[model samples]
Target: MTTITTRTVEYPADGLTMIGHLALPAGVDRRPAVLLGPEGMGLSDVERRRADALAELGYIALAFDLHGGRYLGDPEEMLARCLPLLADPDRMRGIGHAALDVLRTEPRTDPDRIAAVGYGTGGAVGLELGRGGVSLRAIGTVNATTTGRPGEAAHIRCPVWAGVGSEDPIMPPEQRNAFTAEMQAAGVDWRLTVYGGALHAFHHPPVGHPVVPGVGYHPRHAQRAWRDVVDLLAECLPVTEDLGA
Candidate 1:
């Protein structure tokens, strides 16, 4: 593994002191960056490690926060906060922009060459950033297939890739269809992958905390989803040549 550096950063968004994790590659050269977001439960070790992994691969990664430095393990609390946030595109864009600013301002980041990849509600934020015309190279999301307001998707200027479990109750067929329809109508390049027989949050590792009814972990599908995300980044934003390896 490459020698990557990590740090804890604090930024303000959603009227809270958001805490995020930043990982930088070995060299001092500017590299393509990624804005990574966590599930609605908040920024946990899972996202931190993901940032580190991206760093090792020579990308500057920032795992953005959702709940102002707190991880909401209780199912009800997570829903209470995430539900409303998910409903509002502006709110989602707020969180994404704050993190994007932090990522763009970093010394090791090439601001023009960037992407957004997120999980769960974090995934929704990535889409919102695309919808808000952020000039992202690509947008990759998992377990979040939410559709934005009518006519808003036309603003997205890049390709998007989404992954979801076939049996996911939260992101059922209707919602997926709606999302795809919007993407197509807007002439946006998009693709969807459905993991057979997996439930909601299938990409998430098994957690000890209380979870909602349709949430479960699928080990194999989770790995596949991650690889797909990496592939998307490699295609849209290459970092190998600038890694100084």
Candidate 2:
């Protein structure tokens, strides 16, 4: 198994002191990087482990925070904080850019070879970064069905891949259609995958805390979703040139 190092990172964004997790692969060689985002429930050990996993794969990874330094276990509280954040493009962009900056500052990160991979509300932020003209190599998201403003997607300079549960009421067929329509209209390279018999947040693992209505986990689909995202990254930003994936 490959060895990696991890640390806590403190940065300011959206008028708050944001603390994120930074993970780096062994050695000092610069490598392709990922801007990882947490779910709407905010940053937790789940995201930290994800960052460490990415590091073990030889990519400099930063799992950015959402609710400053806190994780919201209460579904209601999570919704209260995320609902407004997800609805505001500028705010989302601000957070994404701040996190990107932090990732770029890492000595082992190849700034020009970076992708944004996120889940749920974090996924929405990744999309917003694309829409806001961030120079990302690619974007991969799960359970995010955000439709950007007209013509904004033209600014996206890379391929995008998204996944959602087919039965997700929060991101039903109509919402998916609208999101795909926007992508097509802007000529952005994009694809969507719908996992049948799954519900909202199906890509997420089981949580000890209460979850929102319509949110559930499917172990099979979750593993598949992770592979899909990894494949997208491999195709768009191959980090194996430095270390194994």
Candidate 3:
């Protein structure tokens, strides 16, 4: 059976209680911990599965909820709620730091090896944390469009890996190019992977979305993205024999 734990964490920012799923590999001590920021729809089953998968890899993964507890099936409604949160940069950064703190404080987690992974809007929030000097070992984002231009990219201390779809309408080629250019100019160590023919939220399975025609599930890209994430974490957060299996 999968070895994991679950609990609720109260966000001190807004007194919001976020359900967090903590997954750890058995027979591991003081493993690196990853703070997972869910996509715009909030913490769904997919995010929980991701936590479990990461745990299997011997990392303590904590999936934190950005939304209080509301899961809206309608795309428009989800966007309505998500957009406002993104608009306030301060609030977004606050939430990201709070989530990071929760993961760092976990008894099973190694504070020095902490990292973060986020989806969509959550990706932007993770970028903000990096920019704010959160001291993370690495940060990975999926279908995210919130990182600032290259001028400010120099502020990011941790390595960042971003995954995007070639056909994503929200983040087109020009924007991706600009982001790449900025990262290059800032001298930040980063990598951008473009999956062919994938759309926004490609990792998420089909669901109702009035703005988009197809659902957000691309199995090939999703699997590849997960692999890249694990690889990045392993590289950035090295495990000593005491911490490794």
Candidate 4:
């Protein structure tokens, strides 16, 4: 097994002190990196582990925070915080930029070689960063087919991959269509994958008491989505051995 190291990071955003998790592979030089975004609830162990896994795969990773380092176990609280943030593109971009800056400032990160992968609200943040003209190598999002302001998507320069459950009521066909239309209008290289028989938040494991309606865990599809994200990274932002030399 490859040696990986991790640490907690703190930064400011949205009038809150955001706490992030950074993961690094054992190496001596700069390497490809990924900006990982967590679900609307906030930064949790799941995202931290994902960051570690990416580091083990030979990439530096930062799992950024939302909600001021607090995990919103109540659906109402999560929606209350995320809904407004999602509605404002500038705010979302600010959050993403703050996290990206942390990653870029890390000595082990290759500034020119980076990707963004996010889940739920975090995914929306990834899309916003792309729309804000960040030079990401790739963008991957799950359950985040939210569309941004008109004409904003044209700024995206990297390929995008998005996945959602077919039965996701929150991201119904209309939402998906709108998101795809924006991508097409922007001439972005984009792909969407809808996993059958899955629900919203299907990639997430069961957590907290009284799970939200219309959200359920699908272990099989969750694994499949992870694999898809990994494949996207491999194809668009491969880390060569020379990067660590």
Q: Candidate 1 lDDT, tens digit per residue, 122-220?
A: 999999999998999999999899999889899999899999999999999999999999999999999999999999989889898899999999999
lDDT of every model, 2 decimals: 0.94, 0.92, 0.78, 0.93
Candidate 3 or 2, higher TM-score: 2
CA displacement after TM-score superposition, residue 177 of candidate 3 (Å): 1.8
Q: Which residue pairs overlap in candidate 2's backbone?
A: none
Instruction: Give TM-scores for every candidate, taking all chains together and pairing residue i with residue i.
Output: 0.98, 0.97, 0.90, 0.97
Residue lDDT tens for model 3, 93-144:
8888777778878788888888888898778888878777678889899888
Off by over 4 Å in 4: 243-245
lDDT for 198 (candidate 2)? 95
Where is model 1 more than 4 Å wrong at Cα? none
Q: Estimate, for each residue in 1-245, the C-alpha lDDT of model 4 and write its tens digit.
A: 88998999999988899999999999777889999999988899999999999998889999999988899998888889899999999999999999999999999899999999999999999999999999999999999999998898999999999999999988888999999999999999999999998899899999966656789999999999999999999999887664443
Global CA lDDT computed for model 4? 0.93
lDDT of 2 by residue, 1-245 (tens): 68999999999999999999999988989999999998999988888888898888778999999988988999889989999998899999999999999999988889899999999999999999999999999999989979887899999999999999999999999999999999999999999999999999897788997899999999999999988988898899998777543
Order the candidates by lDDT, highest first: 1, 4, 2, 3
Runs in model 2 lying further than 4 Å from the true structure: none
Give per-residue lDDT, candidate 3, residue 29.
74
How much lDDT does candidate 3 score? 0.78
